[model samples]
Target: MKSPKASSVTIALILLLITGWLLWSSAAAAEETPYIRGAALIDTHGCLACHSGNLMGAMKVPPLRGCELPEEEFQAWVLYGCPQAQPGRAQQSRFGMPAYEGHLDPEDVQDILAWSQIAGHEVPDQAALSDLARGEQVALKAGCFDCHGPLGQGGIKNTGSFTGAIPGFSGEQFKHLCDDGDPAAIEEWIRHGTSERFLSGEPLAGLGRSFMSSQLTKMPAYQDILSDEEIELLVRYCLHINSLGPMSAERYEAHRAALASSKMEVTGQEDSLAGPSLPREVAELFSSKCIRCHGPKKQKSDYRMDTAAAAFQSGDIADFLEVSVIQPGAPRESLLYQFVSATEEDSLNEVFPMPPSEDERLSPEELKVIRDWIASGAPWSDKQTLQSAYSD
Candidate 1:
């Protein structure tokens, strides 16, 4: 009805209004997304308890303050502990991280992802500044500091029934003893736990065994818990620490003196033995592997072996020792021997065998040593004799 130019201008104005409306709608939707909501959810869940500086247990809790990961990957990790993005690696949390699959909706996960991305962007890249900074973060997040020290120097862990003196990562002797700048070896140790040999085929021998044994808490096989990428980061951090050279002698000696003073408080001074002295090797084996769960802090099934007195005094352990002994010289009759010696094929119905977890079982050679010791009458050794032998 109107002129063509007037009608054309009206139509153009309507189209412009529609475009503006669409833009407004898109912005509003983005603003309303769950990521904003995730910020509140993080606080409500008390996630900072373990992930923050206020750690709950002896286990290391990886920090999430500046955590960076792909959006999909981050969402998956938040919803389901660990993602199976990679093969040959099982997903598990040795240091408890509860999954919030059903409890949190898709919207919740998205919100959390949003918050993490925002927070991550906020954190400055300190690792870029210095190797020490990177190493410190890795150590703290991986829990090295929990066992080592605040400075990655030596420290002692004295948990009621167990006493372990952790060596400094910076020590030249420790660096040489562990590995020779091989990241793969370091990575292997991180994933599968450290052994008496480095990835470069170096023998830990006497010093390695002593150092490994000094760790009061068993080093967990992190392959199940950490991603391969995370493990690589840790290796880089450790290598950097090693390059820094040994801890100051003064600090190391001070730490040792402090440990000596506190040793009695951690491991009760009960030194009574009922049988012949056990060999030093056998005692060291017990201290490193057996004492963690069976000793003072936690005694599963009322069995303990922290002290010679505890080993002989505990009725259950004493009975097991007696029943397992065959004619005072046969190790095969011993239930303790049988449990440690059982192969996967033979242990179908057995109550989860000794060292409970499959990853932490004693090696074949270690098992043989235990078997040999049991066969040799399972003699009880005094602490002083054992200590003197260790010093030699």
Candidate 2:
């Protein structure tokens, strides 16, 4: 009954509506996990990146245990720097948080205040602190920032190197330094000053090796200076900062602009890994033992390891870096392997183990299977295998 032009217009409108809804739903569903609470943000965002201390109010990190600031003032001081806080800047010191304004939302501020009322008064359990927080202390004590720069923002010039600078933990400079794929390379740097992976690999290393060897500021081996535990902490810290993307407001807006005009569909398993077909045994193991938390629907930290990709992912990192759940060929470099292997320790260093429930914890034998599977290459099983696993 409608004219052709009228029908065409209606169809266009319907398509527009559909696109908008998909975009909205995708945005909403994308962040399946809860936001970090205000208190954790301190550790997660490395509020201590600039200042070192507690909420009880020190010079910069501050010590605000029992004391309370008005909401508006608190928000102003945090979201916007307090001009009054900057007195005299020492040569090696900084005042106020990083240049991140508008990254946090209103709910985040409210959450922070609420937490201070309850938990802020008590001395924080060092063991309870996030690895990122703990790693900050370790780096400070060991004087890593001297070379790496504050918060591992390495910008110190190194003559003869390809990039001509010591690489920071995150960003293009770091990717330029190494493959940026495996954290083991990070560990190797800490243990031996230079990793084999970095020296042997291409694009930079092969061409840059002569320059790297001739550089004025060479990384010193910490084998004697640091204990094994301290070494692990340092690696975690480096990886933590390396991954904490510090997405600025401007860049995110540009991302939004691109998204607004793009034809990208936000399917449910947006973060799903794409790789080799998953084997039946692995699929069965994941469906039975892991999928409840790291499944297709509800993922903690956006890590849905049980998706058809179902390769591996133990947990999230500094809240910004995007790490694939598993690296197919390397078990030692895989967080999934490390978490499963170290679950027995439940130590301060280890992340909360996969399948956090004590009763549901994987057996040693099961862990061995995971290790072997990872070492062999973490392949995702087929849909039939997944269906069969679920059936059992």
Candidate 3:
């Protein structure tokens, strides 16, 4: 899968590992200041992609920050794609609020709303050591892992891509996506979802789009999804993770576990990073409750949380859907818990809570079992689940 220019890519990765990438403690990161995750979400989802990055309206998309409507009315329009304009405005425009109804949970309405009230806030201009954590969340929330491979290590197959796979966040392969670690280049891909220069420039001589057309899985445009600040954080994250060199998928997960353990040490959360162990008490609970759908016996949608390794291996329906099935210590962050915890009306994109039926839904005690399990590091007993049962 390597390009002929492998040597050049290797040299670049070595340089990055030696001097460019620095993983520092959270305190060191705070020195760079922080932007709200809301703002970060704004960027990754490309909220400002069409309109001017300055929050000034462009083409026909209205200015995101200067609506004169009452707060309640504006908030309503935001949650329900801002299709309603007043006496002076046209009903149809090239771009308005992207549909948030089924895509982003209702809770996100507030974070996005809070960002709208602020002027010119973006993910910090300078990189934050703290970006490590938030960037991962951004990537996960944006579904980078689904296309790039788990944790952005980049091994997912792409039928017609040059390397025949999506590139990892880091490594020589990323040069196709970003040139010489240039921030603008990375930002171009993030905000526009494709680099105009790369597609039409001397390098590919206009074949970039052609090649992309034949690919089975392609990068989605974030113009409507992410905002500018979110793009920068993800860009920094890609550069930093690239310092790890090209790792096989197994090595990547081992590295991830090590990182998780280190995170626990830094935060002093004893159970935040899970290990491969499940209390015997809860093992049967999964067997009785979850396995009917997500167990080894009959994996629904190719997902089974039956094994510890399987739990972390992953799940995702789409962007804004919970990318991490079990986010270790964050029960609410985990899609598994989110699904089981939802009420009937909380359905996303028509996706209902677990059991998909009123009769079989977990009891409150049963709900607490998984929720507390997730909060307590979501320990599971097993190892080495494949990314999927049928495919590599």
Candidate 4:
């Protein structure tokens, strides 16, 4: 028989092995949480405060929800800066959230997206199952592709020539877009349906040629074609496919710092505030939809919708800002407008069309008010009218 000390040592070794095995098993299970789970973890981390799930960005924070980007491209986005996020400036690290590098593992990032389909949310398992294709077919049937490109990639650049609309995605890609959740912008696109939509803040309009305002002719209402849920799911898929680039931690930090400096710089130099000319109805609209993102200087999205004048020239408005799946003027029609206008119960998109998948869209009266404003050419009323209308 073995000595008592040897027996004790052997027993200890067996217990240690068991403990190690259990830990390894647990880690494996955690790692396998999948894309949706990983995304949920991110949600739990409070990323939604700044980064939306719908990929529709706000003034301060851009969208990140169902962004459709490849892993390599997405990795770069997470790590570097480009026109998609910003040029020269770093990734945004100052937007009410923490840097995810130390807090999340790369595998965890993958899992967040994998588990994204829970709660019956749409998550396409195959690339062939693209809602963009379906949307493209609809766009073609609607004569949207005549200028917008084969996929809704063509858009108008600032120089007055037509260019490609923003890219589209396979079904799986839509998930990332919804995760960012900039539904207000989405609603604006749907309601206003104009080339001047996103122009108030962006500069890309400078590179384009012809605009597509004439294409705003009536077509089959989306309500007649796709279910609201189907349309929203498509939107989410597009964002996920488009946002497949990596996020750069270093660039994000740099941009965060720059944003801080830009704020300081603007504050010290500005003493000559412009005289107010905003109307009451428009003013109320601004207060409700424009202020949260654009009120402060160094406005988010590089565009400020706060003042009609400031936003009027911003290229992204006309070119396309975050919001509707379709860029306003091109082959891309504002689905936001289409879904919000629906009067039937089945009209509700996968989620409500505004605020977010997590939030409610405007009431019918409010939507009708906005729709009327857009239909009447969306003139910028003066401050007096705006104040009088919204004061109650």
Q: What is the TM-score of each candidate against the true structure?
A: 0.27, 0.36, 0.32, 0.21
lDDT of 4 by residue, 259-366 (tens): 222222223334224322333454565566535545444354454555445544443433354354222121113333454444345334332233333244567666
Candidate 4 lDDT: 0.39
Between candidates 1 and 4, which one is better according to TM-score?
1
Q: How high is the lDDT of residue 81 in model 1? A: 64
Put the candidates in TM-score order, highest first.
2, 3, 1, 4
Q: Write the per-residue lDDT of candidate 3 for residues 75-103, one digit (tens) a residue.
A: 45655555453332423323455445444
Instruction: Report how far off residue 81 is in candidate 1 (Å).
Output: 54
lDDT of predicted model 2: 0.54
The candidate 4 region of ten consecutive residues with least summed lDDT is 167-176
Cα-based lDDT for every prediction: 0.54, 0.54, 0.57, 0.39
Q: For every candidate structure, what is the RMSD over all alpha carbons to the true structure, in angstroms?
A: 24.3, 19.7, 18.0, 25.6
Per-residue accuracy of model 1 over 261-354 as CA lDDT, tens digit each: 2222223335423334566677787776666667667676576666665664434543644553221234555565666666676556442367
Candidate 2 segments exceeding 4 Å error: 1-130, 176-178, 203-206, 247-392
lDDT of 1: 0.54
Write one digit per residue (lDDT tens) for candidate 2, span 177-293: 446636677778877888778677755455457766778889888888988878887786565445433222212222222223222222324323443355456666777877666
